[model samples]
Target: MENTKGISRARFLAGAAAVGLTGAVLPAGQAAATGRGHGHRGLKHRGVVYTVGAGETPGTAWSAARMRGDVRVIRDDLHADTIDVTGDGVERLTATAAEAAERGLHVWLQPTLGDVPEREILDGIAECGRFAELLRRQGASVDFSVGCEFWLFVPGIIPGATVLERVDNLRKGNVDMARMQRRLARFTAKAADVGRSVFHGRLSYAAAQDEEFEPVDWNLFDVVGIDYYSFFPQPADYVCELRRHLRWGKPLAITEFGTCAYVGAPETAGMGWDIVDYTKEPNEIKGDPVRSERTQAAYLVELLEVFESMGLYAAMAFEFVTADAPHRPDNPRYDLDLASYGITKAIKDRPDDPSSNWHWEPKEAFHAVARRYGRRAGPGGVTMAEEVRAWTGPLS
Candidate 1:
C-alpha cells in the first residue's frame, strides 16, 4: 500500500532552480504600501494549492506534500480534479485537513462549484461550509472559496453546453466579460455572507488574473487573491498590472502562479496546459523541441523577483505535484512533464501499475522555491514604513 503520510515518489516537478535569479526585476512603481495591508492579523499566506486529483482516489499527492512541511499554508483543492462534491469528496477533504493539521499547516479549502442553476448556487457554499467546519473543529486553520473560474467551470454562467465549449468561448472572445464580472461580484458577495455563518477564518476566491476584478467588493473578504500568471509579452508592464490590486489595500495574494517544467515553457509562458494535446493519456503526450527545464527555472527566478520586490501579502506556487502526468525518456510521446505545473514530477510507470513508483522525485523547481521561502522565513513580513503600507479602505 502507498503510504499516505510518507514520501514514496522520487519525481520532482519542472524548472525551479535559482538560475539567473537577477534577470528581470520590475519596479512596482505605484505608491508604496503604508503598512501591512489587510491580510490576516497574524498569518502571512505562504502556501501551495495542493490538488487531490482522481487516480485511484484523491489526497495521495497532497498527503505527500503535507509531510514535506516546507509550505506554511495548504490550499487543498477538491474541485479541479473531481467531478462532484459527493460524500467521497467530503471524506477526501477531511483527510487533507487531517494531514494539514498533523503537520501544523493552515488550510485553504477550495471546492469547485459547477454550473448549477442560479437558484441552486448556494448549494456550493453549503458544501464548502461543511468541510470548513470539519477542518476547523479538527484544529486546522481553514479558508474557503465558493468556487474556481465560475464563468468557465460552471455551465450556463458562460454560453456553453460543456466546459470545453466554454473555454473555447473564452478563447474566441465570444463571452460577455462585463456581464460575467457582474455575476462574479454578486456571487462572491453571496458566497462570503453564507461562508461566514459556518467557517471562521479568511475567505477569498481563486480568480484568474484575466478576469475583471474591479467590480469585486474587496471589503467582503479578508484578502484579494489572483491566479496571477506572467506571460512572455509582459514583464515591465506586468508590475504595472499587479499594482492594480495594490489599490485594494487588502493583502493581495498571488493565489496561483507557476511555470511548467518544459525547456521553452517560459518562452511560451502561461500555456503549459495547452502545450501538450490532452487527447492522449498524460504519459502518451508528445514532447516538443522548445522544451527546456532551464527556461522554466528562469521564469521562477523572474516571478519570484517581481513578487519579493513588490512585497505583496503572500505567494503560493501553482501546485506540489500532478498525478498521471509522468516522465518517460525513451518514448518522448509519453513525456507529460512538458505540460505539468507541478513542483515535483511523477515517475513514469506502466499504466496498469501506477503504484510501481508510489512516490515522486523532486524537480529543479522544488529547490528554487524552498530556497526562496527559506529566505523569506528569515525577515518575515514586509516593513510597514519602507516597502509596504498599511491596510486602507478599498479602492473608490
Candidate 2:
C-alpha cells in the first residue's frame, strides 16, 4: 500500500467527510449494553488495549498515551533485548512496560516466528525468555503469541500459493490442525511460565466445514485470539463465528483486522481504489464514510459488549501507525502501506491527526470506552457476579 502523499489534502478531507456519520458516543458508564449472554469470566483486571504499530516505534508509545489504552501491543522482535545484545534493548522494553503500568496501561509482547537472518531459532527463544523475564522484573502482566499464521508466511492451500509449493511447505512445517494444537500447547506453556495470562494469535481461515481450518484450538490459551477482517457487507455472521470460539470459556481478542482499500468486488479485478491494503495496494474501504464509521464502530462496540456480557476477555485493534514514513523494509511485517488504519498518520507526533484518513480515532471510541467502563473492573478482576448483573443487567 502506498503512502497518502499523492492523495491531495482535499481528497483526504473529502474521504473523512464522507464517513463522518452521526451517532451518540456512549460514555464509560453507559457503554455496556444490556445483553443476556454467558461465557467464562476472564481475568478480572482492567482490559489492556493497543493500536498495533512497528515494534518499539515511538509512534506506538505516543499512540498509547493518546488513545488512553491500558497497554501497547508491540512486536517482540522490536525489543532491544531481542535485537540488541548490550541488554539495553531489554531494559528499554521493561521501562516501557513499567511506564505503561504506572499510567494504568499494560504492555503486550508480540514475538514473530520465522527464520531470522541474524538469529537462529534458539537465539529467538533465548531472546523471548529474556523479554519475558524483563516483563516480570518490571511487574508487567499480559502477553500474546506472535503471528501464528504459519499458513500465510509459509505456504498453504490458500489461493495465493500454488498447490505443489503449498503442499511441500505444509508438509515441512507439519501444518495440520493437530500440529497447531501441539505448537500452541508448547507456546502456551512457555508464555504461562512468563506471565500467568496469555493469548494465542491465529488467522481466521475462510469459513470451512471442518474444525481444522476453523481454528478450534481455543483451549490452548487463556484467551482465544483470531484475526478478523471481513470483505462481506454484513458483520453479524462474523460476530457469531467469534462467539462460537468464545464457547471455550476464555476471552476473545482480535489480533489483526482492517479494511483493505485496494481490494475490489471481484478478486481478479484490478485495483480500482488506492488506500491501505493489508497484502496489496488500496486495502481500505473507500466509498462511504457515514456507513463506514457506523459499520466499523458498531462492529467494535457490539463485540466489546458481547465479550463483556459473556464474561470473555478483551480485544485490541490491529494497528496504530501508517506504513509510509520510517518504513521497515527488511521486515515483511512492514512491507505494506497499511498505515492508514492508524488513528493518526505516521508523521504527526500527536494522537489524533486531522491530516490523515482514519478508520477509527482514539478520542471517539477510546473516550467512549473510558467514559462508560473505565471505572468499572472487568469480569476477570471482579467476582461479584450479582452486583455486576445489577449494574449491567442480567447475563444469560
Candidate 3:
C-alpha cells in the first residue's frame, strides 16, 4: 500500500506505554472549566477524531501497522479514552475502530461521504452499520454515525453536484429551505432505520450548526451530536446558543471543535483552514499569518469549559493530526501547518534523511489537551481546582 507521498506502508505496532509524549504546555491561564456546576459532569467521552482515506493519498494512506501506531499515540500520548474513527471506506473504518477498541478506547465509527449521491451514501452507512454490529457483538465498544453534515455532502439535498457548488448555492440563497427540510427529514429517518437494523450499539449523527439539522428526528438516535464551531470574541452568553438542542432531552455531544494553529485563527474558528492557497505549486497560506500554537490550545481549553458549563455528554477535539498539511517553518507563506487544526504538525521534509518524512512534532495544544483530558472526573466529578491539585505529571 504505497501512498502517493512515496512513503512505504510498513508493518509496525507498539504498546501504549512504548513512547511518552514530551513537551511543556505553554501557560494560557487555566480556565474555570467547572464553572456553572461545581464539578465536571454530563461529559463521559473525551478524545480526538482520527480520519483515514479510502485509498492511496498523501497523509491518509493507512496500513495496518500505521493504524496501530496512531491509535497507540491517541490512547497513550494524548490520553484520549475515546476515538472517533472516520473515513469513506467501510473496511478502513471498521479496521481502525477495531484497533481502537482493542486498545480499550471507545470507538465512534463515522462515515463521512462527501459529494456522493443519496443512495450510494445510504448504502455506505448501512455497510458501516453492519460491520459495527459485528465489532460490538465481539465485545468492542462501538457507535455508528449515519452520516455527517448531509446538506453539504449528500447530492439532491442542495442544488449542486459538488460540495463547493452546494455551499455556493447556499451562500447565494438558491436553496428552498422548506423543501430541503422535508427531504432531510425523510433521508435522516431512513438512515436511522437502516442503521438500527444492523448496529445494535449506540447511534448518532454528526450535525452541522445549521437550520437543516433542526428537522432531524433525534429520537431515532441515542445521542444528539453536533460538530459545533463558532468565531472567537464570543458573546457573554455564548453557551446558551446550544441550549435549544438540549430540549430534545437527549444527551448532547460536541462531536468536533477546534481552531487552526495561527494567531487570529480563533476569530475565524471553523473557517480558519480556508487560509491555504491551493493553486500554488507548493500550496501555501494566503497571508502572513503569525503561527501561534498557544492560540489554538487556549481556545480549545476555553471551549472545554463552556461545554462543561453546559453539562454536555461528550466533547471530542476536531482532530489529532492532519497528515496532508505538513509543517514548513522556513517561510510563513509556505507554512501550510498554520491553517491545520491538528494538534500534531506533520513534517514535510527531512534534509538529514528524506525517508523519515512521516515524522510529526506536537504543538502546545497537545500538552494542553493532555493536561485537561488527562484529568479523570470521579463519580461526583471534580472542580477545576481539585483537578489541578490532583495533577500527577505533564501527561498524567
Candidate 4:
C-alpha cells in the first residue's frame, strides 16, 4: 500500500510537504571515525533493516524460530554488525531484539505503527521503550527509534487518517505547511520525552529531508537518523547533501537506504517498488519490469561506498527480506521479488519443491554486501564488539 514514484521516500515527502513547509551524526573528538576519511574506512554500524511482522495479517506473521534463522543469516552470512529490528507491537520488537542480541548484533528497535491515533502511537512507543530497556538490562546492545516518518504515519500532521491519505493530501497540496511543521516538532519533542522516560539507551527518529519545514530538533536524539535514498538523476556528491546533519554534533546514521531489484530501479531508488500493484491480495508487476539482481547489488555497493567516504556512525540498508514478495521465477510477471528491496529473495515454502523448502535464497546484493561488510572485519576496521561499544556508549 506504500507508493512513492521516482524520488526516494524522503524526497517524495519533501516534495509533498513543499505545499506545507520542510526537515545528525557523530560524537566529537571521534572526528577521524566520521567525515570524509581514508578509502572505505567503514562505518561502526554496517547494518540492514530486519522487519518483524506485527502478526496483524497472515502475510505479516512469522515464527520466532524463523526470525532467529534470519538473524543468523544477517550476521554469519551477510557479515553485518548491526540489525535494525523494525516493526509494530512492543512484544514483536522485543522478540526480534532478543534474537539479534543473542547473535551479538546491535539491535535498533524501531516500532513502525501507521494510521494509529496520537495517544495510541505514544503508548506504543513507550511500550517499545520498556521492552528495549529489558533487552538492554539483559546485556543486549540496543537503541530505540521513537518513530519513523512521523509526517506520513502520525495523524494530525498532514490531515489524513491513513498514510496513503496523508501522502495524497501532500500530493494534492491541501495542507497547512506551517501548521503541520509546528505539530510535527511538538509531537517529536513529546515522543522523545516519552521514549527517554523508559528507554535508557540511544534514541533516534527516522527523519526525512523536508523541502520547506525546518529540521527536527536533534537536541532530542543521541544520533541523527536519516532515511536517505538517492535522488534519481543521482547527485554528484552524496556527502554534500548529507553533510548538513553533522552540524548538530550528533553521530550520523543512515537509518534506511537502498533500491529495488529491477532494471532502472537505481534511478528510482525507494520508489522502484511502485511498479507493484498493491491494490490486490497478490501484488503483481504492473508492466514488464525486468528483474536484475545485479543492478540492485551495484546500487547498494555504490551507496555503501558513499556512506564509507562520509564516515557515518551506521548505514542500514532499507531491508533484508520481504516475505510477502516471494520470488516466482516460473512466472516472471508475477514475481514480486522484482519490486522488493530485500537483498535476499524469499521463496514461498512448497512441499513438492525441495528447493523452495529452504525458505529463501540470496540475491547478488547479499554477496555484494557481504564483501563490503567483510572488509570491515579486517585489520584496523570496526569489529562487532567495537560497533556495539560505540553504539551503546555510556547511556546518560
Report the number of the highest-TM-score candidate: 4
- TM-score between model 4 and native: 0.83
What are the per-residue Cα lDDT tens digits for candidate 4 across 252-323?
889988888878887663567678776775556898887888777777777777777676788899788776
Model 1 quality (TM-score): 0.72
**Regions more than 4 Å wrong, model 1:** 1-43, 56-88, 115-121, 133-139, 211-215, 232-237, 280-287, 351-358, 377-396
State the lDDT of candidate 1 residue by residue for 1-396, as single tens digits.
221110111101111011111122344545455324533232255566565533543423344354334233222321111111111134455556556655556666766534356545566567667777776787766666665555545556557665556556655667676786677677677777877877777777766564332246767877777766656455556667677667667777677777777655655445555555645543355445554554455466556556655666666667666655666655666666667777777764553455554445666666555444544422563332311122232211
Error of 3 at 176 (Å): 1.8
Better of 2 and 3 by lDDT: 3
Worst 10 residues of 4 by lDDT: 21-30
TM-score against truth, every candidate? 0.72, 0.48, 0.82, 0.83
User: Considering lDDT, which of the candidate structures 2 and 4 is the better prediction for this target?
Assistant: 4
Q: In model 3, where do residues sit more than 4 Å from their true spots? A: 1-42, 54-60, 212-214, 232-236, 350-356, 377-396
On the 0 to 100 scale, the lDDT of residue 123 in model 3 is 90
- Local distance difference test, each candidate: 0.53, 0.33, 0.68, 0.73
Clashes of 4: 12
Give RMSD to native, each candidate: 10.2, 13.1, 9.5, 8.0
Quality of model 3 by C-alpha lDDT: 0.68
Cα-based lDDT at residue 396, candidate 1: 13
Two-way TM-score contest, 2 vs 3, winner: 3
Cα-based lDDT at residue 122, candidate 4: 94
What TM-score quantifies how close candidate 2 is to the native fold? 0.48
Residue range 1-396, candidate 2, lDDT tens digits? 111221211122222222221111212232232222223443232232232223333333333343333233222211101110111133343344455544434445444333222123224434544554555566645353433333322222221243233334433543454664465445434433443322222211111112334334444445556544333234344444445554454445544433312123111111212333334432243333211222222333344444444444444443333433322223323323222332222343332332442222242223323332443435344233322332332221
